[model samples]
Target: MKFSATKSTLVYALQIVQKAVSPRNPVPTLSGILFKTGADQLTVSATDLDLTIECTVPVTVHEPGNIVLPARYITELARRLPDVPILIETLTAGSAATISYGQSQSNIHGFPADQYPELPELPEAPALLISQGKLKEVIRQVIFAASTDETRPVFTGALLEIRDGALTLVATDTHRLAWCRLPVQADEIISIIVPGKTFTEMLKITGNSEEEDVTVYVSQSHVFFVTSVMQISSRVIAGKFPPYQQVIPREFSTRIKAVTRELLEATERASLLITEGMPVVHFNLEKDACVLSVHTEAGWIREEMDLQVEGEPLQISFNSRYLCDALRAINSNEVLINMTGPLSAAVIRCPENTQYLSLLLPAQPKPARSE
Candidate 1:
């Protein structure tokens, strides 16, 4: 295969597709990237069985052919090449690839293109087109909460539910949950568990702008995302997510509305005084003010912030990290905290929007002071 492509363009495409290349690939061929040069374009593809990424860039092809070269070497070469056009010619008959730039020459050992595994064929089905910006927003709001541990296979992936005219992305790591909704129009209502790692890669490639709509292909075992010149596919995780709806508190005896940034700052300051074994932060809620207190053998801290409260007085203990994460996720200025009892989970939400809810499990009880 003979092709000439701009160094900058070739480097961009290589960087994008390398997200799927795994160093510990089981198959030797999987470690290399498949390069196919057609009449007008050159394509590079990489896959690790579970996930695949492919990108195409404009190129001048003198001969239409294909080859498989080491992904790592190609990416490094392209990145370091001089700011000029690059010429690549592969001789499959000899299993060699020649890379050239200004006053430079390099030869790389490669495998026949046929040795690479064929990418999965996208089936003809109704696809959903949604703005890349909105899709990325939903992912940012929830992907962080996905369980990093693989013990619970289901929680390691994000639950994508398409119903009516909306798409909901939900993720949880048992301790905290994140949910985001987006407006979408699809012919069919579907639900699938997509691996969080795959979704994150897709987000990285999708970018943040809504310049174009991203096409999503869904099946029982696989999900594919197609952009203008890039495509990503991943194997779906097969399992039912936990019943997340039931865990959110519905009613509360005490409610408080406070500035999100203030609450987050207070929690961060108090968390410093907490120790490793002990992860609890005390919340002393009164009529119109809230006090966050943390104590350790080394020192103690107390933070008081005023808020709008319209319920009975209450004091609760909770994991400082959970509250801080939830507060940081809220985009609005004022946040609402709904507490039912000292031992119950406290529901956190934005006062203006009811679409998002965060639940924090209470910490173990602390010793009471003798009056």
Candidate 2:
């Protein structure tokens, strides 16, 4: 196959699709990117069985064919190519490709396109529709709470729940939880768990074009996110997400309403004193204010922030990093924190009419009676 494309266009597609390249897979072709010739475009694809990324760019095709070139070599080569049209041709004698640019040329051996795994196909109709801006926001607000522990695979992903026209994204690491809700046009209820890394990669590739609505196609085992020129597919995590309703406290004995930014900043400062491990921060919730203090080997930090506190005063300890994550993820100006006791979970919600909340479990928590 032979094709010519400008350096910028070719490099963009290569870099985007190469994100899914398998680093040390047993299948040699999986470590390479597939290059296929279209009528006037070149399609580049990479996959590691669980995740896949593909992109297409305009290219003048001389002969229609396909080849799988080493992702590392091809991407690096394209990055250094000068500002000129690159011509690539594959020889039939062996699975090898010759890339010519400017006055120089490079030959790199590759694998037959047929050896690459077949790309998964999705249903023609989309299961749900959500705006790019909304999806991006949901991912940002919930992905951080997903656990990185591989042993507990279910906690390493975010739960996507759609019920009665409402979409909820919830993630937890058994310590803290993040939940975001959005409205859709669906009547049936469906739930799926998607890996945290998938969300991270999607956020990285999607541009800031909030105007476009992303079409979502969900099968029994996979999901497809399709846009005008891009498609992202990933295997759904196979397991059950914990019932979030059971974990959130329905009623609280203490309610602390404070500025989200101020609280987040103070929590971050207290976290600075913790050199390692999930250190605990003390919260002294009072009638009209809350005091945050941390005592560690490095130093001690004390901060008091004014807020509208109600009910009984309470003292609780929570992981500093977890607390900061929940506060920073909040998009509202003020947050209303509901607490039951020193041992129960503390729920953080916006004071405004928003359907978002985070639940943080206290550190070194004791039973209510034991406390």
Candidate 3:
């Protein structure tokens, strides 16, 4: 394959596709980025069995061919090259590629493009168009709650549910859960469990183009996200996501409204006192104020913040990090905390926005002291 393209354009495309390449992959070709040159464009692709990223850039193609170059070496070399036109040509009977820009030239060995696994084809179905901004927001709100442990495969992915005219994304690690809902137009109802890593990479690719629309194509086993110049495909985790609706509390015995920033700050402060394991922050809600305290072998901290309390007073304990994660995910200035009891899960929501909900399981409270 022989192609000529500006260094910046080539670098950008390489950056997008390299996310799918991992050095630890057992398949040697999976560690390489496939370069396919057509009439006026070059397609770069990388895959790691579960996820694939492909990017296309305009290039001057002198000879039309395909080859797979080492992803790490090519990406690094392209990034370091000057912002000038780059000439790339395959050598050694397509076993290697030589990159030249100005006076600098480098040759790298590669595998035949035919040996690379083929990217899954999109099914013949209507694609769903979604606002990039809204998609990114929902992902940021829930992806953090996805469990990193691979034992319970379902917990390692986020559930995307589409029904009626709304779409909801839910993720949980058993300790906490995040749910975000938005209005969307779809002809048929669909549900899929997308691996957490997919969202992480998608967030980076979406960038700040809120006005742009991302086309979503769902197949039996894979999901595709297509943009103007890039396409990302990921294998859907095969299993049933936990029934999250049952875990959400239907009612609460106590409700407290407080400044979102203030609660986050208090939790962060109390976390410092916790030395080992998860930090537990004790909450004591009264008529007009909420008291947060933490006691650890190293030290103890107590903080008080004014709150608009309703219903009965209550005391609850939660992992400080969990509370912080929920609070940070909220975009509103104020937040509402609904508690059923000391042991029940506490629901956190933004008063201004009802579309997002976070549930945090309470930590066990310390026993009372003997007289």
Candidate 4:
């Protein structure tokens, strides 16, 4: 292969595909990036057998061929190279390649193109069209609650369900759950479990504007996300998502409406004061206000935020970290808190929009140490 591309354009494509490069996989080509030169563009691809990323950029192609070079070396070299066109050429017979820049040149041995794994072929199904901005927002709202424990495979990813015209995404870690719903036009009912890691990477490539649409293609085993210049494909997690509807609280004993930012700030401060053993923040919902406090060996925290209170008064304790995460995800000025009891599942939602909500299983904090 032989190609020359501007440093800026070349570095961008390399950096985008480098995320899928295997760190130390047994397959040599998996750790490298496959570079294919075409008429006037360079197509870069990398895969770790599970997730694959490919990006294309305009470049000057002297010869149309393919090679696989170390992702780490190529990306780092392109990033540090001077602002000039860089050239890469491979030998006719051997796996030898040379990178040329102004007054400098370096040689790197590459793997034969045949050794690289092939990208998955998309099924001939209708593509689901969705606004890139809406998808990005929904993924951020729920993906953080996904379980990181790999032992329980179902809980490690988010449940993606599309029925009628509503698209719902739900994620849970046993202790807490977060869900969001969006409306879209769909011809078929679709339900699948998408790995949270894949959605996290999708956020990086998808544009934040609602004008652009992302075409989603689902095969029997793999899901593909395609944009104008990029593509991301991942294997679907093969498991049934839990029945998440049973856990959402429909009744409440006490309801509090407070400013989202105020509560988030208080929870962050309380989290800092909490110790390793006592990771709880006690919420004392009194008349007309909510008081947040946490008692630890280091000190004590007591913050009061005023809001509209309804129903009965109650006190509940929850993991400070969990509470902070839920609060930060809410994209609203005013948040509604519905408490069933001290030990029951407490719900948090935006007052204006009912599409998103989070549930937290209250925690028992250790008692205050001796003064």
Candidate 5:
């Protein structure tokens, strides 16, 4: 195969598909990127069995063929080339690929494209067009809460629940939870768990393009995200996501409204004084103010901040990191925190925006609770 393309275009295509390359992959082909030239476009693809990313770019194709090249070597070669046209050709023997641009040339050993695993066929599920901006936002808000532990495989995915024309994304790590809802149209009601890694990669590739809508295809075992120049597919997680609704309390004994930024800052300060193994922050809430304090054998910190409270005063304890994660996920000016009991989970949300909700597990009480 022979092709001529500017270094900038080749570099961009390489970067877009490189996310699927796995360093420790059992299949050597999975560690390389597949390049195919046909008509006037150059297609690049990479896969780790679970997820596949393919991106295409315009090119000048002199010969139509395909070759698999080492991802790291090819990507670096294109990235370092001057901003000029690059010529690439696979030898008649299909043993190596010659890359040349601006008087610099390099040859890298190549693998036959036939050895690469067959790309998975697209699922038969119906596809729906959804706003890219909203889809990107929901992914950012929920992906962080997904469990990294492999113990509970189901919790490692983000649950996409579609019912009555409403789409909600929920993720939980047993310690914290994040939920985001959006209005969408669906021909059939369905709920599926897509791998957290898939969404994370999609976030890295997609941008804030308000003009285009991402097409999402869901099936029993797979899901697909298609864009103008790229396609991403992954095996969906099979199993039931925990019943998150039941865990969220219906009512609360205390409610406090505080500026999200201010509270996040206080938590960050208090976390410094707490030890690594035990990073607990105490929340003391009164009628119109709140105090966040942390005490350890190393040091102690006390921070008093104003809050808008409803109902009687209350005090609670939680891991400062959990609180910070929840607060950072909440993109709002003020947050309303609902507490049912000291031992129960605390739910937080923006009073005006019902689309997002986060739950943080309270810390275990010490022998003597903090005042």
Candidate 6:
């Protein structure tokens, strides 16, 4: 295989696909990137059995062929290369390639192209086109809540539901739940569980372009995300996700509306007082303000923030980290907290947007204190 591409273009493609290369891959070829040269472009692909990433860059091809090179070696080399065109040529009989730019050149040994596993074929079903910005935003808001524990497979993935011409993504670690919905144009209802790690990698390649549309294709076992420059295919997690609809509370006895930033800041400060065995932050909801307090053997902190309260007064305790996670995911200026009582789970939502909701389970009861 032989191709000439600009250092910047080749480096970008290599970096994107390298995310799919597993560091501890047992299969030798799985740690390498497959490079295929065409008449006008070079395709770079990497896979780790479950996820695959492929990207193409414009290049001048002297010969149309393919080879698999070490992902780390090639990516690092290209990144450090001078800003000039890079020429890559592979021997016809051996898995050796020479990469040269300017006066620098290096010969690297690689695995044969046939040794690499083939990427999953794209599904023939009609694709769902959605804004890249919206998809990335929804993933960012919910992926953080997915359980990192691999034992419970369902909680380790995010539930993707498409119904009524809308899409919703829900994720939870059994302690806190994040849900985000977006309206889209689609015909059929679809539901699947996607590994959170896949979405985390997708965020890196989607970039910050909001105008671009991402085409989504789902097969029987794999899901594909296609954009102008790159494509990602991941195996769907197999299991039934928890019925998240029943998890969200429908009614509340007390509602507090407060500035999102202020509440987040107060919780962050209060969390500093938390210790190893204790992580609860107390919330005292009054008619005109909400007070967040944390008391531990080390110290005690109380912060009062103004808020608009309705329904009734209430008090509750929650994990400070859970509160911070939900608050950081919210982008609105004002957040609405709906509580049925001091013991029930609290529902947090944006006052201006009804499509997003976060449910946080209350912590263990704190000792009673004088008012």
**TM, every model:** 0.92, 0.94, 0.96, 0.95, 0.95, 0.96
The digit string of per-residue lDDT tens for model 5 on 169-237 reads: 999998989999998988767789989999999888843265688788876677888777888889889
lDDT, candidates in the order shown = 0.84, 0.88, 0.89, 0.86, 0.87, 0.88
lDDT, candidate 3, 28-81, per-residue tens: 998899999988999999988889999988999999999999988999999999
82-112 per-residue lDDT for model 6 (tens digits): 9988999998774989999899899989988
Decreasing lDDT order of the candidates = 3, 6, 2, 5, 4, 1
Candidate 4 accuracy as TM-score: 0.95
Question: What TM-score, to 2 decimals, does candidate 2 have?
Answer: 0.94
TM-score of 6: 0.96
* Candidate 3, run of 10 with poorest lDDT: 362-371
Each candidate: how many clashes?
A: 0, 0, 0, 0, 0, 0
lDDT per residue as tens, model 4, 1-371: 78888898988898888888997999988999999888899989999888899888889989899999988788988899999778989999637689899989989888988889988986777558887788888999999899999999888889888887999999999999999999888877888888888888777763325567778888878888777777788888998898989999899989989888988898888888766774788888878978888777788889988778888888889988888889888998988889988888889999878899999888864555665
Candidate 1 residue pairs in clash (backbone atoms < 3 Å): none
What's the lDDT of the predicted structure labeled candidate 5?
0.87
lDDT of 2 by residue, 80-158 (tens): 9999889999998539999999899999999989999999887777888889988998898888899999999999999
Deviation from native of the Cα of residue 275 in model 6, angstroms = 3.3
Residue 344, candidate 2: C-alpha displacement in angstroms: 0.9
| Candidate 3 off by > 4 Å | 206-208, 367-371
Root-mean-square deviation of every model? 2.4, 2.9, 1.8, 1.8, 1.8, 1.7
Evaluate candidate 5 by giving its C-alpha RMSD to the native, one decimal. Answer: 1.8
